[model samples]
Target: MIMYLLMGLTAAVVSYGATWGARVVGNRLELHMPIRSRDMHSTPVSRLGGVAIFLGVLVALIVASQSFFVKDIYRHNFSPWGVLAGATLIVLVGVADDLLDIRWWVKLIGQSAAALVVAIWGVRMTIVPWVPEPIFLENEMIRIVLTAGLIVTTMNAFNFIDGLDGLAAGVAIIGGTAFFFTAYWVHRNAVLLDYSDLATLLMAVVVGSCIGFLPHNWFPSKIFMGDSGAMLIGLLFAAAGIVSTGQITSGLYDRANGISTVIPILLPFAVLFLPLLDLGLAVVRRTARGRSPWSADRGHLHHKLLDIGYSHRTAVILMYLWTAVLSFGGLAFAVFPWQPVLAADIFATLLMGLVTAWPYLRRGSDEPVA
Candidate 1:
C-alpha cells in the first residue's frame, strides 16, 4: 500500500513539474492551439500538455516496477515495458500533431505503430466473460487486432471529447478511480491467478497524474492538453482496461459471486459511456452534415449545458457528478449489493438534473444552440 501511494505521489509531483515546463516550452516555441471558431476557449493556449502526463506515468511505473509485488506480476507476464514503449510512441504522435498539424493519415499510421507494440508485448483479450463459459479469442493475430482496435477506439474517443475545459481529464480521473478499485478487487480475489497487480498500479498512476494536472487544467485553463495529453491519457485508460479485462481464462470469475465475470470489460465502458456517446454523436452528426468527423464543433454536451446558462464551472461540475453517478452505480452493481441505493442514485441525479436545468426548463423548452 505504501509503495502504491509512493508511486501515485511520484506521478503527481512529476506531472506537476512537467506541466510547468510544458507550459514554458510551449509558449517559447509559439506552439499555441489557436482558438478556432468552433472552439470554446476564446484565446489561443499552449497545447503540448501531454509531455507532463507522459513523464508522470513513465516515472511512476518505473518506480512501481521496482516493488516486489509488481516484480512478481512482471514475472507472471504483466510487463510495463511494452505498454510504455507504445505510450511513448502515441505521445510523440500527439505532440507532433499538436505542434506540426500532422496529416490525419500520418497520425493514424503512428497510432497503429503503437498498437503494434501492444501486440508484440502479447497484451491481448483472450477471454470475454459470458454465461456458462468465457468466450475465448486468443488467436494471436485476432487478439492483436482486437486489442489494437480497442486501444485506438478508446484513444480517439477521448480525443473526440476534449472539447471542454478539464472535461477529458475529469472523466479520466473518474474512470481511472473506478478502474483502480475494480482492479484491486480482482487482484485481491485472485480469481484467475494469472494477472498481476499491474492493472491496479497503472490505474493509480493514472489517477495521480490527473489529480496533479487538474490544478492547471480546470476551468480557465493555463494550457490545453492538446492531442498529446488527450491521446496519452486515452492510451493509458485503454491499457488499464485491457490489462484488467483481457487476462481471465474462464467465465467463472468472482468465485464468491457478487459481480459477474464480465465486470472487467463492462466497468470501463460504463465509466466511459458518456464520452463514447459524445463520440458517436459527433461522428454521426458530422457524417450527416457531410463534414469530416475530425472537424471541431460546439455541439458537445458541455456546449449544451453552457448554452443553457450554466456557468463553465457549473457545467463542468455537473458533468463530473453525472459521470460519478454512472461510474459509481456501475461499480456498485459489479461489487456490492447496490440495489438498496440504486433508486437513490437515480433520484439524486434526476433531481440534480432538474435543478441544473430548471432555469431553461422554466423559461421554455427551447434553448439556444451553440
Candidate 2:
C-alpha cells in the first residue's frame, strides 16, 4: 500500500514538471486548441497537456519496474508494456486530431488500433459478468475482440466529456483512486498471484498523472488536455479494469455472497458512471437528430448546468461531487456491509440533487407568484 502511494507521488511530481515543459514547447510550436463554438474558454490554449501526463506515467512505470517490491510484476508478464504502448499510440492519434481536426473515422481507426495493441499483449478480457455460471471468455480471439471493443468505447466515452477545465482530469483522479483500492483488495484476496497487482499499479500512475495535470487544467486554464489527454485517461482506466475485474476467479465469486459477487462485476461502471452516462446520452441525442454522434454540441450535462446558471467552477465541482459519491459508494460496498453503504449513497445522492436544483427552485420562488 505504501509503495503504491509513493509511486503515485513520483508520478505526480514528474507530471507537474513535464506539464510546464509541454506548455513551453506548445507555445514555441504555436500548437493551440482554437476556441470553438461549443467550448467554454474564450482564448486559445495549448493542447499538449497530454504529453506531460503521458511522460509522468511513463517515468513512474519505469521507476516501478526497478523497485524491489514491484519489479516482480515486470517478470510476471508483458501486459504492463502493452498498456504503455497503447497509451503512446492513443496520445499520438489525439495530438494529430487536436492539431489537424482529423476526420472522425480516422480517429476511430486509431483508437481501434491502440486497443488491439493492448489486447494482443495478453490483457484481454477473460471473464464475463452477471451470469449464473462464472463464464470466462476462454477463446483467445473472442477475448481479444471484446477487450479491443471495450477499450475503444471507453476512450470515446471519456473524450466526449472533456468539455470543461479540470473536468476530465479530476474525474480520472476519482475513478483511478476507486480502481486502485478495489484492485488492491482483489490482488490481496484472490488467488490470481500472476497478475501481481498490475491494475493497482496502473491506477497509481493514472491518478498521479491526473493530480499533476489538474492544476494546469482548472477553471481559467492555461492548457487543455485535448483529445490526447482525455483518450489516454480512458484507455488507462479500461486497461486497469480489464486486468482487475476481468481476472476474477470463480472461486472468489462463488465463495463470497452479498456485495462481493456484484462488486467485481460492477466496480468499473460504478466509477465511470457519469462519463458513460453522458456518452450514452450524446450518442442517442445526436442520432435522433440525424447528426453524427461525434459532432460537438452544447447539450452535455455540464453545459446544461451552465445554462441553468451554475458558474464554470461550481458546475465542474458538482459533477465531481456526483462522481465521488458514486465511486466511493462502490468502494465502500466492497469493504463493508452493503446495507449501510446503500443507505448512505442514497442520502448523499438526495443531498446532491437538492443542491443541484436549489438555484433553479430559488429563482422560481423569487418570481412574482404568477
Candidate 3:
C-alpha cells in the first residue's frame, strides 16, 4: 500500500514535471498544432503534452519495479516487461504521428505490431466466461489473431475519444480507479495471488498522472495529449484489462450458483464503455456519410455538447461524472455478492445513462445529424 501511494505520487510529479518541460520545448520548437474547431480558444496550444505523461509513467514503472511491493510480482511474471516494451513502441509511434502527421496506415501498422508483440508474449484471452466449461481455442494462430484484434480495437477506442480537453484523461482515471478496487478484491478473496497488487499500483500511477495533468488540460487547454499520450494510455489500459481478466483463478465462477465470470471480463468494457461505444458510433456515422471511418469530424459527443450550448468545462465535467458512475457501478456489480446491490447498480446505471442523454433529449423531435 505504501509502495502504491509512493508510486502514484512519483508518477504525478513526473507527469507534472514533464508537462512543464514539454511546454517549454514545444514553444521553443514551435510545435503548435492548429485547432479546426470554431468553439476552441484563439491561441494555438502544443500537442506534445502526452510525451510528458508517457515519460512519467515509464520512469515511475521502472522505479516501482525495484520496490519491495513490486519486486516479487515483477520477477514472477514477464508480463510487465512485455507491457513496458509495448507501451514504448506505441508511444514512439504516436509521438511520430503527432510531430510529423504520419500516414494513418503507418500508425495502424505500429499499433498492430505492438499488439502482436503483447500477444506473442502470451497475453491472449483463452476463455469466455459466459460459456459453460472453459472454452480454449485449439488453434494458436486464431487465439493470437483474436487477442491482437482486441488490443488494437481497445487502443483505437481510447485514441478516438481523446477529442475533448481532459476527456480521455478523466475517463482513464476513473477506469484505472475501478480496476484498482477490482484487482484488490480478487486478491483479497484469495482467488488470485497478490499480483493484483501490482495492477493496483499501476492504477494509482495512472490516476495520479491524470489528476496532475488535468489542471493544464481542462477546458481552455494549454496542452493536448495528442496521439502520443492517447495511444499510450489506451495500450496500457488494454494490457491491464487483459492481465486482470485473462488470468481467471479457480472457483472464480460457480456455474451451479448462477454466478458468472463474464462480469469480470465485462468489467473493462464497462469501465470504458462510453469511449468504446463512441468509437463504434463514429465508425457507423462515418460509414453512413460516405466518409472513411478514420476521418475526423465534429460529430463527437463533446461536439454535440458544444452544439447544444454547454460550456467546455461543463461538458468535460459531465463526461467525467458519467464515466465515474458507469465504471464504479459496473465494478460494484462485479465484486459484490449481493444480487440486490447488483440489480440496483444496473438500475442506477440505466438511470444515469438516461440523465446523461437528457441534453440530447431536449434538442430532439428533429433528429440532429451527428
Candidate 4:
C-alpha cells in the first residue's frame, strides 16, 4: 500500500511539473492549435501537453522501479513496458496531428500500428469473456487481432469525447479511480491472484497521471491536452484494461467475486459508455450521409447539449454527472447487492434530466441561455 501511494505521488509530481514546462516548449515551437468552427475555445492553446503527461508516467515508472518494493509489484511480468511502447506510438501520431494536421487515414494507420505493438507485447486477450464459460484461446493470431481491435476502438472512443474542456481528463479520472480501487481491493482479497498487485499499479499510474494533468485542463483551460494528450490517456486506459483482463492467470478469475467474473472487462465499457455511444452514432450518421466515418462534425452529444442552449461549463458538468452516475453505479451493482444505490442513481438521473430540459419545458422566453 505504501509503495503504491509513493509511486502514485511520484507520477503526480512528475506529471504536474512536466505540464508546466510543456506550455513553454509548445509556445516556443509554435505548436498552437488554431480556432476551428467545431471547437469552443476562442484562443489558440498549446498542443504538446501530452508530452508532459507521457514524461510524467514514464519518469514515475522509472523512479518507482528503482525501489525494491515497487519492483516486487511487477516482478513476474514485463507488461507495463509493452503498454508504454504502444502509448508512445500513439503519442507520436497525435503530436503529428496536432502540429502538422495529419490526415485521418494516416492517423488510423499509426493507431493500428501501435495496437499491434501492444498485442506483440503480450497484453492481449487469451480468454473470451462469454457466457456459460470462458473459452481459452490457443490461437495466438486471433488473440492478437482481437486485442489490437479492442485497444484501437477504445482509443477512438476516448478521443471522441474530448470535445469539451476538461471533459476527457475529468471523465478519465473518475473511471480510472474506480478501476484503481477495485484492483486494490482485489489485490487485498484475492490472495491467490498474483497479478492483482500489478493491475493495481497500472491503474494507479493512469489515475495519478490524470490527477496531475487536471489542473492545466479544467474549465476555462490554460492549456489544451489536444490530440496528443487525449490519445495518450485513452491508450493508457485501454492498456490497463488489457493487462488486468488478460495478464492474470489465476483460476479464481473463473469464479465470480460479486456479480460476475467479467466485471473488470465490463467496467471499462460502462465508464466509457457515453464516448462509445457518441462514436457509434457518429459513424452511423456520417455513413448514412455518404460522408467518411472520420469526418468531423458538431453532432456529438456535447454538441447537442450546446445546441439546446446549455453553457459550455453547464454542458460539461451535466455530461460529468451522467458519466459518474453510470460508471459508479455500474461498479457498485457489480460488486455489491446495493439496491438503494441503484435507486439513488435513478433519482439523480431524473433530477439531472429535469435540469437539462428545464429551458425547453418552460414553453416560453426567447432569450438564450446566459
Best by TM-score: 2
Across 133-205, the per-residue lDDT of candidate 1 in tens digits comes to 6688858788888888888888888888787789888988887887777776656666456445777777888
Error of 4 at 356 (Å): 3.5
What's the TM-score of each model vs. the native? 0.91, 0.95, 0.90, 0.91
Error of 4 at 31 (Å): 1.0
Q: Cα RMSD for candidate 4? A: 3.1
**Per-residue CA lDDT of candidate 2, range 1-370, in tens?**
8888888999999999899988888888989867788988787789999999999899999999998677788886888898899999999999999999999999999999999999998488987765554476779999999999999889998998899899999989987898788777756666665545778898999999889989988988888888999999999999988876665564443323364457776778988888999999999999999999988898998998898899999999999998898888888877777788889999999999999998898998899965
Order of candidate numbers by TM-score, starting with the best: 2, 4, 1, 3
lDDT of 4 by residue, 1-370 (tens): 7777777778788888888898888877777867889988888888777787788788777776677666765566767778778888888998999888888999999999998888888478787665555578899999999889988888888888898888888888787777776666555555553433655676677667778888988878877777777888777777777666663456434333443556666677777788889889999999999999888888998888888788888888888888887787666654566576668778977987898787667645656767
Error of 3 at 344 (Å): 2.4
Question: Which TM-score value belongs to model 3?
Answer: 0.90
Once all C-alphas are superposed, what RMSD does model 2 give against the true structure?
A: 1.8
lDDT of 3 by residue, 197-243 (tens): 54566677777777777778887788888888888888777777766
The regions of model 1 sitting more than 4 angstroms off are: 76-78, 191-196, 250-258, 341-345, 352-356, 365-370
The Cα RMSD in angstroms, rounded to one decimal, for candidate 3 relative to the true structure is 3.5
CA lDDT scores, all candidates in order: 0.78, 0.86, 0.76, 0.77
User: What is the model-wide C-alpha lDDT for candidate 3?
Assistant: 0.76
Error of 1 at 216 (Å): 1.0
